[model samples]
Target: MNHVISVINQKGGVGKTTSTINLGCAFANLGQKILIIDLDPQGNASTGVGIENNERENSIYKLLIERNNLQQYVKHTKIENLDIMCANVELSGFETEVAEDKNRAFILKGIMDELRQKNQYNQILIDCPPSLSLLTVMALVASNSVIVPLQTEFFALEGLTQLLKTINRIKMSLNKMLEVEGIVLTMFDKRNKLCAQVEQEARKFFGEQVYETLIPRNIRISEAPSHGLPVIVYDKYCAGSIAYEKLAAEIIEKQKKFNFAA
Candidate 1:
């Protein structure tokens, strides 16, 4: 079955886009066909995967606004199994543009339903904006589950509480099947006692909902996007790359268990 997951964290600078890109790359490396939907107005996920700004004329904004064929918007990345529906700054206006529509939240869901019929990808990751806005809501409504990238720092848990409430609210009213796939601890530093504290707290609260893989703060991960590549592609042996690869494997294993149970 094809899985549609939203990589989201309302808090900014929490490695949301980074996790989205690298995780998709890792899944591709594992021979899974992956499609990353760049829903963020920043379009960082698109840039991270090497989609140029000039090449984003038929972006997610057009797809959302025009309700066009999804295939027309999907752009293949340099990686063999990875593709992306690019986004641009114009996506920032989507919320306002659809304010009066009662079914606005289901728009992305409609497109996703079409994608599901094609069965072209093993995984589809939606890179959401850093806010609990209309765009984020659309992503949540469209996705089967979410992968939250939690930064190991102060106020991280506080922000997570609000995000959880939002998820529950949407679950009750919109997407009944929506679930949290896993929480990834990002930007971790072993030397930082605070990072350890946060991880402990997260594991205590979320239990198995938190993945074992920890994405460390690495220069290679930081440099990859500028080079228009994922860290695993940029520096495969790096700590960050290895961590994301492990995360991909972990997610795949979890999916197998879920499928078996189902």
Candidate 2:
């Protein structure tokens, strides 16, 4: 079965892109076919996986507003099992280009459904931008579920409330099946008392919605992207890589439970 998961966090610097790249690689390391969609205009996810800016002529922008062919856009990354559909600054103007379309949100969903039916990928991970605009709405409509990364910073919980409201509103109006897969805490500094407090409060409120895995603040995780590799591949023994591997395993286990129930 294929699953499309949007790695979203409207708030920036929450480790959304980092999680998307490494988690996808983690699954790939398990021998699963994965496609990573870089939906952000920043193109960090694309570059993180070694897709250069000059090589994005046939990126997601073309796939969305121009050519709707996956083969024309999908590009291979350094990882054997992971492929990517990139994005660039042109994506920022997409909203204005489709302003007259009544069903703009469904554009991405339609394209994703085609890829889903082909069953080429076991997992499709979308790295969304840091805003709840039409792009994020489109991602939510296209995804089976979303995985949010919450940074252990002050006022993190306050921002989560607003994001949840947006998710609920999207569910009410767009995709009713849109579900939250889980939330992971990022940049957790155990030496900091405030980080511990944030984790405790988050667990108290979110409970089972929060994953048991915690991505600690690690220099290797940040350095891997500069070298255009996932942390798991850049340095497999790093804390970030270990946590993401655990996250992928947990996600697979959850899928088993979901399949059994179905």
Best by lDDT: 1
Residue 236, model 2: Cα distance from true site in angstroms: 0.9
Candidate 2 stretches with Cα past 4 Å from truth are 259-262
Instruction: Give the poorly placed runs of model 1, Cα more than 4 Å off.
Output: 260-262
lDDT of 1 by residue, 1-262 (tens): 5799999999889999999998899999889899999999999999999999999999999999888677899899999999999999999988999999999999999999999899998899999999999999999999899999999997889989899999999999999989888899999999999999999999999999999999999989999999999999999999999899999899889878775111
Q: Which residue pairs clash in candidate 1?
A: none
| lDDT tens digits, residue span 1-262, model 2 | 5688999989888999999999999999999999999999999999999988999999898888864567889998989999999999999999999999998999999988999888899999999999999899899998888899999888899989889888888888888877878889999998999999999999999998888989999999999999999999999999989999999898888767765111
Q: How far is 256's C-alpha from truth in model 1 (Å)? A: 1.6
User: Can you list the residue pairs that collide in candidate 2?
Assistant: none
Q: Residue 189's C-alpha lDDT in candidate 1?
A: 95
Residue 247: error of model 2 in Å?
1.1
Q: After superposition, how far is residue 62 of candidate 1 from its true place, in Å?
A: 0.2
